[model samples]
Target: MSALPNNPPPNVSKDAVARSLAEAHRLTDPEITMIFRIEKPGQESNPAEPVKLLEVNPNTTASGIMPVKLMPHAPSGIFFPSVIVEVHPTELEDLKNGNLLLPNGWKVNYDRPL
Candidate 1:
């Protein structure tokens, strides 16, 4: 996980980062089925803060360990700070079904898809 710099107010909006992520990564085969922002446990996070997201993709390999990605959104003018976690369909279902929990105390507060 790339630590988002705690220096300045985030210049990249979640919306912008979302768009850039899809575009820059060109997620095709395993297209994103769902997306939602996550609230890291033990802290208060406003919309202006860096985001952590869970993205569900059916074709994404379910290696048991979900891959975490950090984006600076440099291609979209930088300043975007966020973590993107790729989850397989089954993993997402497990989470929704209460069979799994986000590691390291991360919580799902925003059910609204991004």
Candidate 2:
């Protein structure tokens, strides 16, 4: 029997490869963060606040940042892309104060329990 190919598809970019690796890390050695929907300017109440477990990346080009998969705010089976940002590892402090702003304009607040 022939062995299956293990390499990624030919159309993948470097960023995609890096993200894939990061996602692998997230699956195994994972970290958690509180995700908040960034309220739009002049908007009213925000949406649901969900806590997500992500991967801890210590040596990213962007220092002190991690990858977080942003799930849909509403109750559904749809999936969303990820947002990378600096994560405050201290859960208590983050809970007390707030989290760092993400590249996607949202905020990530604490390291949640697994």
Candidate 3:
């Protein structure tokens, strides 16, 4: 018996490849930013404040910063993206106090464990 071709069947639509390329291009562009709201335990969501587009560490044991405007005024909890910076509580506190300065018009929001 003849061996089947390694590639996809010829019946597949050519538009499929084009569509996939378009999607990949969109994902690669830096203009896309995913926003995730922070949620506290026992609470469905934070009504007073909400954190969006938070950056988090890899080990799931650290917190990071985001734009001040995007951060909540009275944050109950904070959410972050899968990739974040790993920092100690003390360091986070220092950052809050303005000791750690970021670029102009930028602020650091700590996502500590409650």
Candidate 4:
């Protein structure tokens, strides 16, 4: 489990994360699945929530992009900030090019390992 610098708003829910991941994965690849595990709050001792990289889809998309997700082992009472998982280098580029869509008020991080 890793730590995120920002925590998600209270309104954020696990279902939302699952749904978003599912949708994102579907857009990137149908066979991709996401696993999320949230870290305990107050654990980071900062505003950031820690998120870990659990798994990635084995199947690659036409652009050689793999679907990725943040899996937290245990979530605290609060929802942490949004973390972006980039399977390929171009994915980030696509995001910058407005080729991809993401939820509002969500922050994108390209630091996740491929």
Number of the top-ranking candidate, with lDDT as the measure: 1
The C-alpha stretches of model 2 lying farther than 4 A from their native spots are 1-24, 28-54, 63-78, 86-105, 111-114
Candidate 3 clashes: the total is 3
Tell me how far the alpha carbon of residue 73 in candidate 1 is from the true structure, in angstroms, after superposition.
Answer: 3.8
Off by over 4 Å in 4: 1-8, 33-47, 50-53, 60-114
Q: In candidate 3, which residue ranges exceed 4 Å CA deviation?
A: 1-83, 103-105, 109-114
> lDDT (CA) for every model shown?
0.62, 0.35, 0.32, 0.42
Q: Candidate 1, clashing residue pairs?
A: none
**Tens-digit lDDT string for candidate 2 (9-107):** 456332333344345446664553333322223321212222222333333333433445454321322122223343444532443364433433333
* Candidate rank order under lDDT: 1, 4, 2, 3
Ranking by TM-score: 1, 4, 2, 3
Backbone clashes in each candidate structure, one number apiece?
0, 1, 3, 12
Query: Candidate 1, residues 22-100: lDDT per residue as tens digits?
Result: 5544455347777766666555344434566777778887765463656454545535466667788898877778787
lDDT of 3 by residue, 5-101 (tens): 1333355322332233224434654342222222333322223222222322232333344333322111321221111233344445555687654
Candidate 2: C-alpha RMSD to true structure equals: 13.3
TM-score of each: 0.65, 0.26, 0.23, 0.32
- lDDT agreement of model 4 with the native: 0.42
Candidate 3 clashing pairs? 56-83, 56-84, 57-84
